[model samples]
Target: MLKKTRVAVFVSGGGSNLEALLQSEVSGGMPFGEIALVVSNTQGAYALERANNHGVEGVCIPSRGNSGFEEELQALLMARHIDIIVLAGFLAILSADFVGKWPERIINIHPSLIPSFCGKGFYGLKVHEAALERGVTLTGATVHLVNEIPDGGRILLQKAVEIRPDDTAKTLQQRVMEQAEWVLLPQATAQLCQELSEKLSEGV
Candidate 1:
């Protein structure tokens, strides 16, 4: 049997996808994973609340003036023996120091198909509004390796949602979230797990 991967999820929102990941892993009868830690950059983030409710240990690493962000983040991951990192709705651009340290070990779920309506200032409902204004028939999510600057990395997987004629930013955002939490989130984590597995098997 393959050993379960110890994954750490970082979030800055309601952590709906984190909830989805936990649910899927528990019910899927799969024995290849566990969420070791859920870290939040903001003290008030609801993701932390979710983590607390689930009894998974949670930590808050403040980005305030860069006091100890990298040190604290690295320490937490190391202490957790984290094998994978997932960024779910985490808005801050992680430091190059951190990304360089982790490389492809980190993943982010972007709110658009990427290269279409992604990058700095295109997060959250802003992305939905941009897609709608551009009249694109499709707008969705992209899960990719995290790099310095927003959306600045290789594309891993993308799944799209249709832009209806009556789409408001809120309406479109709802669809994007649904696509994210229900499908892309779990699939992305699984894909990363497979990639890491292959990387190990190749070296054997």
Candidate 2:
């Protein structure tokens, strides 16, 4: 049997996107990927619970006030032989040093399309708020390679969602997740996993 790529999902708060990825693993949407570990910067994050429910290992590294945060995180990823890292609503900004170590091995899901309501200070419902405030008729999600620049990496996939007339920030956020983020994240992860599996098979 071919080996499955080991994946680590980093999350903060609710981890709705992590839930989608976990579901995909079982449903064959991500056949070449195995969610080997879930790491959260916040202790007691609900995402850890979601990982546990699916029988995947989850840990908390506690980024707040911890200078060794990335060091500890890197050690854990190495110990588990993590092949890819997925940032699903993880709030902390990773240092360039840590990001350099991963190169294109890390991916992140942004709430809005790049060069739109993305970059620093736009996260969670705030991205949706900006789009609504700007009166954009269409806003969507983007899954892209994680780089030192926030949401500046090469795009992998994007799906557009229409902004309804009655949509508030909260409502728009939910719709984007349901219609775009949930769909694109899993597809992109699977694509990377398949590519990585191929590279590994060739001993690259």
lDDT of 1 by residue, 92-161 (tens): 7788888888878898888888798888788888888889888899888888888786788888888878
Each prediction's whole-model lDDT (CA): 0.82, 0.95
Best by TM-score: 2
Predicted model with the maximum lDDT: 2
Query: How high is the lDDT of residue 152 in model 1?
Result: 81
Q: What ranges in model 2 sit over 4 Å off?
A: none
Clashing pairs in 2: none
Instruction: Give each model's clash number.
Output: 0, 0
